[model samples]
Target: MTTASWLAIAMATIVSAALAQEGQTQSEEIEELEEIVVSASRIELKASEVGSAVTVITAEEIERRGDRYVSDILRDVPGLAVNRTGSFGAFTQIRIRGAEANQTLVVIDGVEVNNPAAGSEFDFGSLLVDNIERIEVLRGSQSALWGSDAIGGVINIITKKGQKGFRGFASASAGSFATHDLNAGFSGGGERYRFAFDASRFSTNGISHADEDDGNPENDGHTISQGNVSFGVTPIENLDIDFTGRYTRSFLETDGSIFNVSSLTDLDNDATVYQRYGRANVAYDLFGGAWSHRASVAVSDVDSKNRSNNATSFTSEGDKLKLDYETTYRFETESIPDAEHAATLLLEHEKDTIQTSSMANEVDIKTNSIAGEYNLSLFDDLHLSLSGRFDDSDNFEDEMTYRVTAAYNLRETGTRFHSSYGTGVKNPSLTELFGFTGTFVGNPDLEPEKSKSWDFGVEQGFFEDRLVVDLTYFNSRVTNLITGSGNTAVNLSGTSPAQGIEVSADAEVLDNLNLIASYTYTNAETADGTEQVRRPRHIASLNVNYRFLEDRANVNLGIDYNGDQKDTRFSPTFARSIVGLDSYTLVNVNATYDIHENVQLFARGENLLNEDYEEVFGYGTPGVSGFAGVRVDF
Candidate 1:
């Protein structure tokens, strides 16, 4: 059935169930379940209290999805679009609220990991989901809290910490295309110290990245190896320290196309990438726990090499170092019961350098930032937040950005009204500022892109919070957007505007059954009112999960739909040109059976419908693939 039909049926059922349960005892339902988030305000705040649109993916939900890459889990999020070049380990891009791929900032354990040599974007394909505890996606402009490369939003991935007791898990899976994945992890802790470690290796002999009809029958393959280690210690009564390190190495088969265009497919090519990230933090509490101070240092390194069949190679390398410090003070007032106030101050400095064999000279940038935020609660039902940031960059002009947000809760109706307005900024990437000599040239006069954005959303609870519905409308106007000129980089004169509406409904229909549905409508246009490339007008998803057999077995079924949009393909008569890519639907299923307290058997099938679709022109996507695996824990 079509996505609309499924939505209709689900809506009808929800309405009917709400009406039926209206006369029942409302007290029978357990309410007061609140999620705490740290991404919105840089401090722990209840999800309902934050005056922004946020989504949290818990580890439980991650495990239930049975996904190998982080991109798979993010695909189901609303107001976001994910596109992959070809197969696993290939280039991946995630756009939020119709923003450019480089506009979003991705953070792992308080470290920014965007590649400086590239377009200041992080590739999600090489990120594995082995030791993640939760992911907080704060949608919309976040420059007031973060620095550059946050014009769209921020994604914060929190890794798992050691618990009180010993725990570990190991899993192995094999699937179509001769895919193999092995992962293991262990964590344990005591009152004073704790440690966690994880490792994973994945390899796939995959399909051709180009269309098989292109006369290149050679299959492209990929391999990835990753490791993570973390340790924490509390030596004093009010002092805590932690250190984390993560490494990833990937080798991929690629088609020899400089711009990844359709007509330049070549099979005899390969590439390798290595990424390393490390962080250390020290936190202390003072004044009887009324004030908290933290200091952290982080480092990121990325090296990539591409080798062609003709025995030619090109290499690029990027390195970054950052130091940050923050302090927050909390105040309480007896005049307004249950109301509190918090004020925070932050300071940061970063240096990034990029070097490429193809460029005659290397490029480096340095930035210093100072920011502050204030959060206030009034009458225990209203929340107000104000924040501002100032940044000084060596490669660009100084920038100042600010934001204001408000959220109110209606206790009687179980509803929340939230709104936020913010400004964001993004600096030009190293490649845009200093391009390769013979291939592309750079324009030093380019200005940093800036955006003004706002979002208004309402959340309501029905049937005693068993069913929840959310609707949000957001708009963004970006100025000085960078676009490619004739072998050079230039900023556009006019502004680009994007507006969208997001709708989501989640219901716990029964004690053992759950349903989730979401839809997004976006109107993305250029300065002259032209449709943007590769951005769909509509996207929808529906998911259902059920548990049976004495709660020992569980199953999940998901449906996803993508609307038609614009793409570029090579035309025999016209050479390379723009074209319309067709819309398609996909269905997926995952099942798990618990054999013992420490063991489980699982299986998953992707693209069960085997729908033929192209996210990017001339790129191949998987079809009707299945995998089975066993997991053990102790």
Candidate 2:
């Protein structure tokens, strides 16, 4: 079937369901409007009170879907696109609202994880779902709250913390491609102290990175091991201390590239990556919890090595250190009766360093910033937020960014109107500013990229909130986009504009069944009016969840559709040219059954339709695959 036909059918199903249950209400509870969002603002705010486009994926939903990788879960998010170059452990990139991959900032437990040596982009390839409690995605320009590299948005991943009592879990799974996964975690806590630890190991004899149909039959394999620890202690009544640390190591077999061509048939090519992250935080409250102070220090280090013919060919190391201090005060005044106000001030400093075998000298960059935010709530129905930041960099000119947002709720009509306007700035990455491999020379004179974005959306709830739908329109214009000219990097004089519409719906169709659907229409182009490569014009997804057998058994079905898009293909015999990639659909299903109070069994099937497709031009994708696992809790 055609892409249009699939989209039409999906839309028809959603519309028909809504109409059929127009006046009917379910007894089961729907998602609460009071859900708190921590990433949207300096202070935690309810989802209904935040003006930004936000999506939250909870651990419960992750378990139901049985997704081992975080990237798989993000594919269903609105206004986002995920592309993987090859098998599970290959390079993965995520673009938000047609923005570049490096434009999005990723934060894990308040620590920035984007690699400074690799264009400041966070690769999602090795990010597993272990120990993650929730993920909050805040869309649009967020430079006012975060610093540089947030032009597209921010993704905050919060891991599980210790609970009141002792708890632990263990799981094991074996699947197709000779894959195996093992995970275990434990947490324990009391009133004044808490701690948690988790570990995981995964391995797979994967498919060929290069398309096997091209006479490349060699299989590539990958393996990863990761560990995490979180600890917190309250030494006094008003003071708290917390610490978190994580380490990951991964090895991946890969196909080599010949000149401009990628994914060539090769036998001895592989890459190894090591990552370490640590953070320490202190918090204090005064004046009966109305005034708060926080101080934190974080560090991130990454080392990568690539080998050819069993010999090390290239290596790079990047490190970042950050320090932050913040204070917030909350008050209510008689001048504005029944209104609440919060003001926050923050000071931050960051240093980045990179060393590569190809560079003669180690490079370093430093930045200092001060930011402030003001939040207002009126009559429990209206919310407003304003924020601004000033950043001073040693290698670039000073920059100022600001954002304004408003959200109004109509209780009688069960409707909400929200809007935001923001300006963002992104400094050039280390590699873009310094030469690499003696081939791509850096441009020290490159200016920072700047952008202005705005979005408006309305959300409507029906049948006592059993069904909810949201529609949003967003537009952004970016200037000073850096591009490669000959062997040196240069900033473009023209502006690139991206505009899109996002639609999403959630409904409780039956007592034990729920449905979620989303569709996006994006028009993203370069300065010369060419479509952005790898960004599909249309994307849609549908997921259905059901519980049965006294709520002891659960099943989930998901469908994803990616519309045709353009991609750049490099060939040894021909010049690099734009090529069209065919559209494709994927179907996945998973089921879980609780046989005992502390034990459960689960199974998952991916690519059930056995579709043949490629996310990146020459890279291969997995076909039909299945897995079964058993989990135990104590």
**Candidate that scores best on TM-score:** 2
- Models 1 onward score TM values of 0.96, 0.97
Q: The CA-based lDDT of model 1 is what?
A: 0.87
Model 2 / residue 214 / CA error / Å: 1.5
TM-score quality measure for candidate 1? 0.96
C-alpha root-mean-square deviation, each candidate: 2.2, 1.8
Q: What is residue 397's positional error in candidate 2, in angstroms?
A: 0.6
CA displacement after TM-score superposition, residue 459 of candidate 1 (Å): 0.3
**Compared with the true structure, what per-residue lDDT tens digits does model 1 show for residues 1-634?**
5465566477658655754565364457565668999999967899878998888989988887787889878877888888888877789999899999899999998889999988789999799888899999888899999888988899899999897889999999999999999999999999999999999999998877875556556678999999999999999999999999989999999884544444547568888999999999999999987899999999999999888884658889988899999999999989879889999999999998999998867789999999999999998799999999999999888999999999999989989999999999999888888884456787888899999999999999877777788999999999999977667889988999999998888877776777888888888888989788777878888877889999889999888888887876655443446689888888889999999978999999999999888888877788899999999998
**Which digits, one per residue and each the tens of the lDDT, describe model 2 over residues 291-365?**
999999999999999999899999999899999999999999899877999999999999999999999889999
Task: Provide the lDDT at 13 for model 1.
Answer: 80
Which candidate gets the maximum lDDT versus the true structure? 2
